[model samples]
Target: MKQQIKHQYAGQYSQLSTKDFNYIKDHLSWELLAAKKCAHYAQESQDPQLATLINQIGLMHQRHYNTLLQYVNPQSVQD
Candidate 1:
């Protein structure tokens, strides 16, 4: 499957901070990659739950990204 909207937004989220930004950036990248891999494996292995779990992890990364963004810019979070 092609990349999702959340994956496409990774770059925008990557620019939020200098400290730990790279780590977050790398993590998001990895999560998307992992999600794809999990999807492939789930398809090959016929395990729907694995794909579901991978998507859940992807959502967690998005939530984490949003939390960090709010932390880095509280004003933006309020508005």
Candidate 2:
């Protein structure tokens, strides 16, 4: 039988393949960029309600990043 990873990751406890590492790395970058974009738009928006909504979305993205961070430390990856 061949060993296969069943999940992208649950936390740092599981083993990660090279593909998993790459996927996580790319997604982390994307999530961070999304969070930053949300923050910027929220700051720039003239409407208070819109700004609040954007802020909420940004916070959600930030939370996702933090969650994904549990998979692997960014510093551990080397190109």
Candidate 3:
């Protein structure tokens, strides 16, 4: 029989190995770049509806970036 490892909630001081840190950093960079590009496209768009949709997409990416940052340094997030 195979055994499954249970997962637990990570705290502020939870250790992240170097490889995990590198992977998270790479993902954060991509998310930030995607958000920037989406925002730029939204600003350049002439159609109101399209601009609004793109802006929402940008906001989603921004939120993902912020969440990842908080995970990286949980102590820094106040709320």
Candidate 4:
């Protein structure tokens, strides 16, 4: 039997006023949630490939978030 894991987005990006920021935040949240759900299924099936794919998706979300943040605040790019 495989254990089930509940994944959640506990981070807050609502305070950001930029539209791009909000867009990225929402998509990132969705991606993370989906990845978490996939992870649960993968664990139940003991599929290493599925687990790796989920991890890659999570990383992509993180990358997208970072790229959006850079677009929102170019000034921060230098810091």
Candidate 2 Cα misplacement greater than 4 A, ranges: 1-12, 74-79
Per-residue lDDT of candidate 2, residues 1-79 (tens digit): 4344544343444666667777888999999999999999999999999999999999999888887775566443333
TM-score of each: 0.41, 0.75, 0.78, 0.42
Give RMSD (Å) of candidate 2 vs. truth: 5.8
lDDT of 1 by residue, 1-79 (tens): 3332232242354233343556665665675566566556655655578767765765665566566555444345443
lDDT of 4 by residue, 1-79 (tens): 3333222222423344355455756775775576566556656656788777766775666566555545544445444
**Model 2 error, position 41 (Å):** 0.3
lDDT of each: 0.54, 0.79, 0.80, 0.56
Of candidates 4 and 1, the better by TM-score: 4
Instruction: Using TM-score as the measure, name the better of candidate 2 and candidate 4.
Output: 2
Which residue pairs in candidate 2 collide? none
Model 3 bad stretches (over 4 Å): 1-12, 75-79
CA shift at 68, candidate 1, in angstroms? 7.0
Q: Candidate 4 at residue 68, lDDT? A: 55
Clashes of 3: 0
Native-to-model Cα distance after best TM-score fit, residue 20 in candidate 3, in Å: 0.7
Candidate 3 per-residue lDDT over residues 4-72, each given as its tens digit: 322222632455667677788899999999999999999999999999999999999989988887787
Model 2 accuracy (lDDT, Cα): 0.79
Give me the candidate number with maximum TM-score. 3
